[model samples]
Target: MLANRVSKRLLVGLQPVFKTPHVLPSSYLSAQNARKFSISSKCYQEQSPEPSDGESSASKKKDEGSRYYVPSSQKRKPLSRVTIGSSTDNARFRRASDTIEFSSWKAGILFVTLGTGLYFFFRYQKEKMDLQRNEESNRGYGKPLIGGPFNLIDQDGNPFSSDNLLNKFSLVYFGFTHCPDICPDELDKMSACLDILKSKYNIDIQPIFITCDPARDSPEILKEYLYEFHKDIIGLTGPYEDIKNICKAYRVYFSTPPDLKPGQDYLVDHSIYFYLMDKDGEFIDALGRNYTEETMAEHIKNHVDAFVSKEIREKRKQGWFSFLY
Candidate 1:
């Protein structure tokens, strides 16, 4: 009875400690006994939902994390603003290029349109002028000479023209002294013909040798080359255009090498005919390349005498001494 009373007294005394406002140890305290209870309770709490009663902190944290995780463009890590900014930069560049292209295209179209308009306008005016010119030309007679004013350089590097041959007839031949087969042979035949003309009728005439190969025949080159031929034969050379025009004027045929490759030498094939020009520089006769000095003179003297009176022909034909007259 006494033991029961003491035990009862101990239990009643412990109830005061248990029921009173005693300070509880923190959950982090890991006494050997406390650690066992903490592990078991932590696992249990993880399995169970955390209490939402009273405290909003847990819910606030969950809301914050979820906000960051929410997908903007289908859960991509990159943000919508970042994607938009990159896309915007690309779009801006494209827009700038497009603007430049549009402006350039617009300018081109405007220029082309303006040019077309002007071209048609000038063309219409030209047609009207041509019609009036045709009517006026029809009122007048005579076939106009088919030729344009040509600029050319002569034997002495001076400009020679029909004016240079004024008061004198010209014997224009396309030949080069270096030409082994045709040029020298043809020139010799011409010289023989001229000699025959000298016997029958001596005329103050000019024979010109134009080079086919300018690379080998400048003014200096031609001067030395003509020494092999008749002393009276004048040599001529110039730039390509001058040579081309001179040849064209006399209907002399000459062509360039298809490709003028550097460091390669090529030959030219040209007409072998000699041209006879009147005192006015009009094309008169084309002599055969096969003519000898006798035959050539035979053809020339008659024409020279035909153009002038007998007295004038006699006086002019006395060449080299006619100046004495």
Candidate 2:
């Protein structure tokens, strides 16, 4: 009985101490409580019996239906991503795709461009060759075969023919004296070019004026009219039929006015140009209204220089062959 009383007294004292508020900080009290709970839970688990194999298998089957439990094969691995988005790379990828898909388009464009270039190149070469051939023919190597045989009368009542075209280069003008402005201006230009060639380059040129209106410009009338111009100018006039034939040979165009009286004042329309012929009466070239006196002189000088140089070269070749022989 005494021992029982002692035990009851000890429990009474411990209960008062357990009921008292803790003097430790909240973190320290929490740590102490968690340690006590962990020790109690460990002892309880140790005392409990292990489950049987059947119970363990049943629990595993129940876990299989759970959302958290997935098969190894179906489990997803964490994705390791590398960001490569930028303007330059995006453009590069787009270009590569376009090139691959549109390779035929690119090839077709290249083929067209190359074909066009080659066509133009060959055409240009052909035109250049044609021009060179024409130049060679005109320079007397081969005959252009223009300015055929003709017979006509001069302003001084003398016979004129294609034979007169030889011994010197001829500047032939085909027009009428009645052409008020254009004829006078062209004649003045011709006279000025002749003066320039004589004074500047010391080159002599023969200027011949052929009338398209031979009916109006008689020999005596032409002689009187030509007296007003340069002394070096030679005037020519002939019957209408003869003049027409000569103009046709020169490829010159002229047309009379509408039907009217025989002596009526009318303008004869004609193509205007100064025809330059070689000493052999072959067509060299024509000078249009565009040529100034000095410019025409220079052009003539160039032709003369080329002719002289060609002659010199031919003489040298002949001399060399003779010496070799």
Candidate 3:
């Protein structure tokens, strides 16, 4: 009985500690209410009905709670289909691109063509200017220092003087009919040159042969000798003093034996040059043994083409731009 009483006292002491069905704290109860409210809000949102087209948006807003509700101003709008450009705009853009491409192609061709044309034009102008300069350099100013008036008898025994040389170009050569090699060769070259000038350029030039050995080469002898080379060549012979004067005037050097016996075979030494005289009987140029027939013809042609009359030159000298002439 004493043991049972001790056990009963122990149970009574523990009962006070485990009493009133273990009531929870206020903080725990508030947390449980918040959890239940969140779960209910989620269920309401999920179970809400989609509004019909005839349903008023105001009524739908009124059914939602403040925590989940959104104002009309803050609501997101539905996405709309967007268009960039119209078909007409695309077609116009394509046309513009094609036009630009075509125009660029045409412009490139024009640029190349224009550049080539300009290049050739400038090149031609430069060449023409150079030719003009060359012509001017060859055609000197003022009267020539070489040829002058002289008198001599022709192969036909006709009286010819410097006046006969007017209105034509003349090539004068001082030689003797007794010349064995050099004179004949030079005469042949001159003949060929004359033929070329006449046939190719249609320019006429007079060829004259003056005798250094006047005593041996009489008018008849000269005629026969020159006819063997070219019918165009004219032979001239005169007195010894006249021959000496003519040679001195033309600046030709010639020598014959001082004292020669009659019937003595001798060769006269003379200068080898063909004097080119213009229409005015003035010296223009001199051709040596070295010049070829073709080259000599070309030189004569150039001189003829560049010829300016003495009257024209004197007229130009009176002009305001005389110095330039």
Q: Best TM-score goes to which candidate?
A: 3
Q: How do the residues 1-325 of candidate 1 rate in per-residue lDDT, one tens digit apiece?
A: 3444444466454532332112333322223234333333443365546544322433343333333333344332211111222445344334445442533778789889999999999996665545434432422234423222345455567765556655676787786545667777887776666666666687767887777666667777777777667777777777777777767755667775787887576677788877776565545567786666777786676556545333453566487766532
* lDDT, model 2, position 198: 88
Q: How many clashing residue pairs are found in candidate 2?
A: 0
User: Is 1 or 2 the stronger prediction by lDDT?
Assistant: 2
lDDT of each residue in 150-192, candidate 3, tens digit only: 8999999999999989999999999999998999999999999
Please write out the lDDT profile of model 2 over residues 1-325, one tens digit for every residue.
Answer: 3444444466454431332115544654455455434433443355435533433433333333232333487443321111233335334334445442433677788888999999999996665545434434655444344466778788789998889887677899999988989888888888989898889889877888999998899988888877787887888888889899888877899999778697799988998989877665667678899998779888776554444233443575489564421
Model 2 TM-score relative to the real fold: 0.53
Higher-scoring candidate on lDDT, 1 or 3:
3
For model 3 the local lDDT of residue 245 reads: 88
Ranked candidates, highest lDDT first: 3, 2, 1
Compared with the true structure, all predictions reach lDDT values of 0.58, 0.68, 0.74
